[model samples]
Target chain A: MLSCKEVTHLLSEAQDRKLSLTESMQLKLHLMVCKGCTNFSAQMDFLRRACRGYLTRDTPRDDD
Target chain B: MTSDSPSSPRVTPETLAALRTDMLRFATLQLRDPHLAEDMVQDTMLTALNKADQFAGRASVKTWVFTILRNNIIDAIKLRARTVSASAYTAEGESLDAAFDTLFKDNAHWSPATRPVAWGDPEDALQDQQFWTVFEACMAHLPTNTARVFMMREVLELSSREICEDLSISMSNCHVILHRARNALRTCLQGNWFTASGCATC
Candidate 1:
């Protein structure tokens, strides 16, 4: 099982899709058994999606 | 508006305007002050003109302007730091560390109203005015040096080596500052912008 610390870094990496397949599997396995981490992972995934959106958008204007 | 001068390369009117707009945004992101940002942009233009020979045509004109603007930002940060009270710095350090621990370690404890957005449509959320306000606020809360590193590395998208040279900090310190900056921004955005309600926050 991945410790909370490992999962934390994984979550950060998962956003950037920097995790390897093996690490992803391990993270998935750990999350299945850890409710708190499962929720945490879900939240990170959500944030990654949102921030990616921001990155893709045009340079924000001052008026907006 | 002329780059035709014998000593100074004529900077086209169009090129100057583009440079001004880009520098204004880049500098404003660092200082959060429009007036100061404009000044930095102007200074960058002046530098670029005076040292036109240094423009090896290596980096794009925009990148060159950004480099100068970032240097100005670091100088501004150092100036501000010098004036800040020691106690104020200490309090910021202590308080921000506690905030980082709380926000990054756990999410379930956060109120539902502040939960992460479902993130189904990032484009829609990106269009929201509230996002910029929250993003800027979270960025503003970071320690000065940390904020500078983050802006240069992430927002300005400069290389770590370039950031170190620009800020006059070591590579390790750049990593450390970037690490702390990312953590602090992540935590602040979560606590302040992610509305537990997970709705379109204005």
Candidate 2:
């Protein structure tokens, strides 16, 4: 059971896919039990998707 | 596959389009200004085109484009920082406590027990302009240095050492700034911008 602070740190790293396997497991386990952390992770994931879409639009055409 | 001529790989139009799409997305995340992001992507494409023969295949095409995009964003933000009149002290003056108070102090409606807004809705808000607005506003609220470092590291996907060299900050300070920026964003997004009512929050 990670503290809120630890979970927060893990969430950021997890988003980057930078966590070690053990650390990833711990974060996942904590997320399963903690609704606040789960929601926070989900929000981060949502933001990444939003960013991906925003970044892909408005690209210059290659005339392909 | 190594070519016998030792010449660089050809950057086909398909490759440029893929790179542009990626660079644009990354720049948009960091700049929060589509125009600026577009310009950055354009600049990246121009540079990549000019240096097409420099493609060593040491990294993926995506990684190379992202590196260029990150560098461009840093340059843009640094230029903006120079033009802005805000001093470091004044920028950092908005204490975390004060920011929290400023948002929630007046709102008698805020509840810790409030049901969090479901972010998974297929509505275009999460995909289009509104998300950028919220993201941009949240970024604007960060302290200048903190925001710069965070954007370079997280959104731009630069390494900490790379950020340290670019920003001329120590590694420890870089980490500190990054930590502060992430925490601030996490709190801001959760409390204000991304709540159950969406607008009810940020």
C-alpha lDDT score of every prediction, in listed order: 0.58, 0.61
Q: What TM-score fits each model? A: 0.55, 0.54
lDDT string for model 1 (B1-202, tens) is 3354455433444556655655675577677678888888888788777776676666666666566766777777656544444344345456555544554435323333332334344345557778766776767767765666566566555677776565566665555455455556555555565543421221
The TM-scores that each candidate's chain B achieves against the reference are 0.55, 0.55
For model 2 the TM-score comes to: 0.54
**lDDT tens digits by residue: candidate 2, B182-202:** 656656666555552443322
Candidate 1 chain B worst ten-residue window by lDDT = B193-202
lDDT of 1 at B186: 53
Off by over 4 Å in 1: A10-64, B1-22, B31-38, B47-93, B103-120, B160-179, B196-202
Which candidate leads in lDDT?
2
